[model samples]
Target: MNLAAAHPGFLSPTGVEIVFVLVGVVTLAAAVITVTTRKLVHAALWLVVALGGIAVEYLLLTAEFIAWVQVLIYVGSVVVLLLFGLMLTRAPIGDSPDADSGNRPVALAVALASAATLVTVVVDAFRTYWIDLDASVQGSTAVTGESLFRHWVLPFEALSVLLLAALVGAIVLSRKDGPRAAGPGPVRDPDATGPAAPAAPDQPDTDTGPGSGTDAEGRR
Candidate 1:
């Protein structure tokens, strides 16, 4: 028997599949705009869109818990943090001239290579795997909680620590020292045992007047 005949559902596309594909396209476009935009704030906003799109995709996949987590952590916290950091650091809100660096070509090449490698690896790994929507939910809160705590606890804790470090670093970098207060007079040491030094007397002024210079020359 042919493969399509053996698996009719695989050959036919469902409404969920269509929506998933559409959301994925939008998410990819938003991500591209996020990286390519000249305005830093706009890039951050686009990132919000991309991250929100991912949350929607998770919802469509019936992973409601994961979707909410994505929204809460990434969309709400991470994006807000990024915007705050940008504003705190006084980053250019308008179009930036130096947004594109001289090494962009090299960066682009590396990004493309990494993306290709990741795509290839993922496709190869999941070529035969398929989720059955009709079956029991796989991404429920209990299941996710168990998996996370049992298998992925270390990485999760590490990510939390990393985020905390980034927060602290941003605060440190953005903090500005206040100017020192000006004093009215010179500061003196209070521990000195000797008598206080007396102030110097003002010097008297001497003028070599014309008649005085002539009298002095005659005397010489």
Candidate 2:
């Protein structure tokens, strides 16, 4: 039977699930590009894409609250922090300098294994479960606020403190040093033996020593 069209129960759910899958694919693609791309800014941009894709998936999962929070925190704030880091570090706009390291292959292997394990766990847990919605389960904004203040407030405050600390630390780290202490250099007296004296008329005449520069009066 046509459960979606006849009962109108499956339309939103199916559409949401389809969008979730599409966003998930985009997330994976962005994550791969984020890791493999050589440019630091490009990697940060791909990170935004991955993060935004996750936010979209969260919305599709009927978690509008989480989705918006993700958009505000990760896409807006965290990625901006990443950009700030790049700017302070003076990351070159051209190709990344020695971005890839010897352990890249091992990191990729571990990532793939982790992905496989997560997929297995999710599939094993929810393969047969079906989503059923009657009336929407309304989430109260006040409840969310109160819960955030009550339970997770410390971590949230700590995160703000951490970001502020990072900004201060970046400022400290990126500052160029001032001029060094200049040791006492050689001092000279303007008149002290710069040139030889002129010869007396009756005395033996002597020419100036080697490589002498005449003064304004032309005597050396």
Q: Give me the candidate number with maximum TM-score.
A: 1
Which tens-of-lDDT digit does each residue in 11-101 have in candidate 2? 3457667777888999999998998888999999999999999988776666667888899999999999898768645587879769999
- Clash counts per candidate, in order, are 0, 0
Query: Over 4 Å off in model 1, which ranges?
Result: 1-11, 142-220
What is the TM-score (0 to 1) of candidate 2? Answer: 0.61
TM-score of every candidate relative to the true structure: 0.64, 0.61
Specify the poorest-scoring 10-residue window by lDDT in model 2.
211-220
Query: Residues 128-175, candidate 1, lDDT per residue (tens digit)?
Result: 555677688878899889999999999999999998998777544332
lDDT score, candidate 1: 0.75
Q: Give per-residue lDDT, candidate 1, residue 74.
A: 98
The alpha-carbon lDDT assigned to residue 103 of candidate 1 equals 97
